[model samples]
Target: MYERTARESMCKFCKYVIKIYGNQYLRKPNLNDIQQLYEVHESKHGFPEMLGSLYCMHWEWFNCPTAWRGQYLRGDHRHPTVALEVVASQDLWIWHVYFGVACSNNNLNVLEQSPLFNDIESGVAPDYSFEIDGVKYKYGYYLVDGIYH
Candidate 1:
């Protein structure tokens, strides 16, 4: 939860920058607080719950393998050493996080036919939407490794 909370703060800070600067830095506030905002916004200016989920779910995060290694490795310094993007419901919990690597590296060919995919469901079938700040967001994640898209 600590990681999530810190991420929420960073996202919120980014969002604030975007609103005030008009995307000057291509900034976007993190939706970590989207749930809280969703609730408040709905009360003040209502929007459909489903829509809320969709909006909240449209976020991406970098899934770095180096970070997972528990040892700092100086990467190219200009690019993400390893990254992946995840899209799914919140907590949308990954049954096998390792599968993330296979997917991102395009190595799923060997893994997909395994029991991994069967055990790990993808997409929004289970629907794990949550409220942050007054907006409802669907939970999804993807790997991003660099500053430039």
Candidate 2:
């Protein structure tokens, strides 16, 4: 009952947020927005055509069901957990987020299962123009650790 109530409240809150700020803050960035982001990112971080930084965080799932306990456990974390992956700009605006992956899955698994990454990889990615070391490229960069394969 508590879980159901909490889930309903959270859904309502999310709907409220989307209704109030979705157009300007929650929606996907357009090509012009991406260009502006790249400019700001470059001037601050010195990385050309950078869209954002990617990171994954794990949240302990104290009430995880018994059947899924093993699926959510990793060797490093004694308890079950859920993983959340996010890409955020320097200003802390979250450009993308994928949540609810079992902690047993690493960043690579999370990314591979992410619909956003699939969409981006399917050619909807922005054509960010930049040159590095005298070589030109058309892809925007998202800074991530070597955890991804």
Candidate 3:
């Protein structure tokens, strides 16, 4: 578990998403950082792109400077900011997400409370397929991780 102070510092990541992705975002848990977060979920976090190739791409996008740089030092636009990404695939369906935030359990909590995982609980599984327009559409976290349906 994260200390009160540590969790507070990590909250910047959550706030950034709330400001950008609105109040709707999934929360997982506070993670060490983008790198560590990827290590934890890459196994179950599928990839329609390829094996390790797409996973690498997902990591790159997650820590991409262009996509995520506003959460550092009072949202300063001059310094280098890191990006973050998450990807998952199921059967013939795949999901991809690129955003800025620490991938910690605590951070996930914040995300869980956001609009992303508003209706999901901690133990529920994500849904990978859904019907749309008389056809089945693959669905999952596009830019955030949470219950997939």
Who wins the lDDT comparison? 2
Q: Which candidate should be chosen as best, given TM-score against the real structure?
A: 2
- Mind giving the per-residue lDDT tens digits that candidate 1 earns over 6-77? 999999998888789654433222344345544655665664332132211111234546554332122323
Candidate 2 displacement at residue 65 in angstroms: 2.0
Could you give the candidate ranking by TM-score, starting with the highest? 2, 3, 1
Off by over 4 Å in 1: 23-63, 66-149
In terms of TM-score, how similar is model 3 to the real structure?
A: 0.22
Instruction: Evaluate model 1: give its lDDT.
Output: 0.39
- Stretch of 10 with least lDDT, candidate 2: 140-149
lDDT tens string, model 3, 1-149? 56987888779877887788653334332222333434544556732212222232112223436554443322323354333434443332223344544322233444444433443444343433444444444433332244333
- Candidates 1 and 2 compared by lDDT, better number: 2
Candidate 2 lDDT by residue in tens digits, 15-132: 9999999899877788887888889988998887788888888988889899999999988887898988888988899888878577777877888888667776787866555667
Model 3: weakest 10-residue lDDT segment is 49-58
Each candidate: what lDDT? Answer: 0.39, 0.79, 0.40
